[model samples]
Target: MTLILAHRGYSAEYPENTMLAFREAAKAGADGLELDVQMTKDGELVVIHDEKVDRTTDGTGFVKDYQLKDLLKLDARFKFASLPNREPIPLLKEVLEWLAGTDLICNIELKNTLFMYEGMEEKVIEMVREFRLTDRIIISSFNHYSIVKSYMLAPEIEIAPLLSDGLYMPWIYAQSIRAKGFHPHWRAAQDEIVISSLDSGVEVRPYTVNKDNELERFFRVNCSAVITDDPVNARLIREKTKQA
Candidate 1:
């Protein structure tokens, strides 16, 4: 069966990266949780998916511009639809602390380039080591420099280079950085491209897959895994589809 990795926790059930969302994802039996990170102005590694806070939270500014203390004050909600007491944006350490002694895997994707956090690669590596999760963590980034910098700093953490349409032959690019896997947007997973990566011993897992038919297509072609926004639905589909 294809491994089902949750994209930013069970984002559909709770706000992405919030403690509630991550707990929901773990409860849903996700094989791994994928989250994004950005360094705050005060040098704390915060778990958030955007450069700015306006969209996902009740705030309006770049995350880089705010100190971690200020960022915590904003309400992180999925609109006003969530249960009144459901969640808040969780610190990366808080997530790690929660994950301690559990078997859930994690993939932490860097939202900004290495330049944004200067020495962020080392900082992230240090945290993963501090948490003693080197074997279970996959560090990834859409920015090519972040990918390369991560590989240079911590080869122990599995690296996956995320690519969108802007880049072609991304398999080659991933290999150049010694990436353990290739995480491309589902639309970018052309047949030859996936096969080329697989042939080179690099697994390819497409991101944010939402439909059964689309997932079946990739599975038929031997793609490694599917990162999804709804892991509970994906797991059900995977079980039923396999039986079919």
Candidate 2:
């Protein structure tokens, strides 16, 4: 059965990457959570999607411009007028603390491809080790080098390469890097792709799949996991389809 990982923490109902979203995602019975991580100017790891805070927060400018203390003042749910309580941007440490109490897995995406925050891999690995969540965490990144560095830092921790478009022989590419999993885009994760990844001793988990039909297709192929915005619906379909 494909594990349902909530993309940016049940983002369909709550603000993406916010603590509220993560809590809601876990409450909805998601097997795992997928989120982005970036470093603040003061060297704190924050949970957010974009390289800048302009899209999601009330603040302007890049996320790296401000210290963690100043960054906390910005409203993460500034655009969500419907959500009564505005959520503050959470630190990676805070999120890890919460996950320490739960059995749910966390896929921490290192958003360093654009900004290329130096020593981010070291910081993230340090946090994971401090929390003793080596088994529960999956470090994924579009910046393959960051994932590679993470693997070098801690071989025991799982690292997955996040590919947006179809990479040629992704399973082989993952194996070349000694990655434990391949995080592919949903459309690119066809039956053959999934099969090859699994057969090569690599796991294939596609991202951002929300529709029922697409979810059903991935589940039918028995992919390792499906990262979706609607984990509740995915969970329901998995239970219904798997039993049939």
**Candidate with the greatest lDDT versus the true structure:** 2
Least accurate 10 contiguous residues by lDDT in model 2: 78-87
- The positional error of residue 224 in candidate 1, measured at the CA in angstroms, is 1.6
Residue-level lDDT tens digits of model 2 in 109-143: 99998898988999999999999999999999999
Give the poorly placed runs of model 1, Cα more than 4 Å off.
Answer: 166-169
lDDT of 1 by residue, 1-244 (tens): 5788888889977788788888889899998889988888888888889888888888898888888888888888856455677355678888887876679888889887634677678888888899999998888887867878887888888899887763576767777788878888998887788888789888888998998787777766777788999999888887777776
Every candidate's lDDT: 0.82, 0.92
TM-score of candidate 1 versus the correct structure, residues matched by position: 0.92
